[model samples]
Target: MRITWIALLCLSLVGCGSEGGKTGAAAEAQPEQTFSWKLVTTWPKNFPGLGLAPEHFAENVARMSNGRLKIKVFGAGQLVPAFEVFDAVSQGTAEMGHGAAYYWQGKIPASAFFTAVPFGLNAQEMNAWLHYGGGLELWRELYEPFNLVPYAGGNTGVQMAGWFNREINSMADIKGLKMRIPGLGGEVFTRAGGMSVQRSGGEIYTSMQTGEIDAAEWVGPYNDLAFGFHQIAKYYYYPGWQEPGPTLELIINKQALESLPDDLQAIVESAARAANQNMLDEYTARNNAALIELVETHGVQVKKLPDDVLAELQRISTMVVDEMAAENPLAKRITDSMRVFAKQSKAYHGISEEAYYKARGQE
Candidate 1:
């Protein structure tokens, strides 16, 4: 009887161990949770660098997350209108969005500082300011009220001044010139005796063709060629002072981002960083080729803005930016931060980057 009882005990222990092992195995086999997010953007479907950045970001997120996270990208007017991307992401209509931060200036007067300010930081300086110079933290705090998180999605580098129907030889020529411009740049243009009309990328061509606008500044040569602005405008101007280095944004709904697993969140951020760098590289390579095409084949006359015109624009821009800073405390904080960073950065770059470029050109 004692032997039988001992055997029964041993069998019971074995059965319990087997069940526990099975449970552990089942837990290990459980699949990871997957997420599907929709991303909306202000650019048309696959429209070169601007539109392609989001698509590349989506693919990167998917690949980096090992298919656990998937983001579907919709171009302007697909899920929502181009201008509505911020609202869509904020209201949870879309999980994410891509666009320029300056587009939200009407909603948040200080938002323009994140994208580009007239006569502000260029791409390299802006990137440094954002990633290292406390710009990102300020940007987040500003967006917290809207329940959205912002990331640097891309930068267009220094954009072209714009396409013009006529030559701008002097400051007087800018008077009453109707143009499609946005952000604080638009305000500066208004202050400088020009009519600044707000229009989307899609609308600019028709507006220019129909005589609604006399001048327009889209992006640089790459996007300008794609939009075929050369077909309508005879002269292309240089040195986009209005947008030195406009940083496009990738905004995610706060709740949506919070729901992501930690690793997935990291993947999203990494993807955005990659996309941001990718755009600058793309614009650099393609803009050179496109500029040659525009000048040679397309008969687009490339002209530098007269020094007097640029000077007047700069003076008015300073006044407009100061006025904006006075209007809002947040704007003041952002602008102030940018001002300090720009001063320090320009001092260094003037000696390093500027001097290097000058030497290289001479060579």
Candidate 2:
């Protein structure tokens, strides 16, 4: 009886050990350590398109991660200044950042290509190049030195030329004009006899109001209307030749991103992608209605930028882009990639998007 009782106890202990092993393994499989991250941006807290994109990204990540990861977002000056977003993310002061890459051109001379090239790719084409045409790889390579990982966070489709207090009748009007523009477009504007001024989104109103800038080229009518530019400037110009498609960046700290579990990392990537497209969708839907209000309700004069002015800007844009490419080898690679892709896109779009627009406009 003693021998039988001892064997049964051993078996009971073995069964308990097996159950315990299973429980431990299951626990290991589940990620229970939650991480809280801070995301900083070059936008006001929840201000329309530029600001709202980051907020939406945070929400998407929380919903997808199911609380495994949470990101707390800070608008410009809340955690860091708008222009400090790059430094904040790279130094791990913040885990993520949102803004255009060109904002960092003072630090990275070739940074403008990732954001927007003057009269280059439109929104759809820009998205394609980033995702498929090797644009993202170049962006990563360029940002790697900063210890950052770049994602195409958001895009403003073709933007308006800007709000001008003085009418642009010809190339002569562009001379000696001061305007708030960014990226390579700003450079082109400068070369075209206009003073290219740089100001963060929040400061645009005060600058324009105080006559610090004679004109400001912000985003589309939807975002521009929200800023009440109609009250500031009467001439709302179209055909944003400066930024055909400005792809805002979601820059993440390399170390912080790699520290996450595989699934959480994937969650972040997926969420960024979703937010990128979501901004475009929201802008596409909202810009039209806001423009109607700007014209009919606000009595804003909608004007087309004269062809001569566009032609001059285009000529200068090509020259500067070429000069920029010549200044650096990496710029050459990026410009070549974009130009080749742009050629293909333009050819196809001529038949598809451009043709369809023409056909639709006639109706």
Segments of candidate 2 deviating more than 4 angstroms: 1-31
Cα TM-score per model: 0.94, 0.93
Cα lDDT computed for each candidate against the true fold: 0.91, 0.92
Q: Taking the tens digit of each residue's C-alpha lDDT, what string does model 1 give over 1-363?
A: 357976787576745446554445666787999999999999999998899899999998899898999999999999999999999999999999999998998999889888888888999989999999999999999999999999999998999999999899998888999999999888888888899998889899999999999999999999999999999999999889999999999999999999998999999989989999899999988999999999999888999999888888898889888988899777788889999999999889899999999999997
What is candidate 1's CA lDDT for residue 112?
A: 87
lDDT per residue for candidate 2 within 99-172, as digits (tens), equals 99999998998999988898899989999999999999999999999999999999989999999999999988
What's the distance in Å from true for residue 320, model 2? 0.4
Model 2 lDDT on a 0 to 1 scale: 0.92
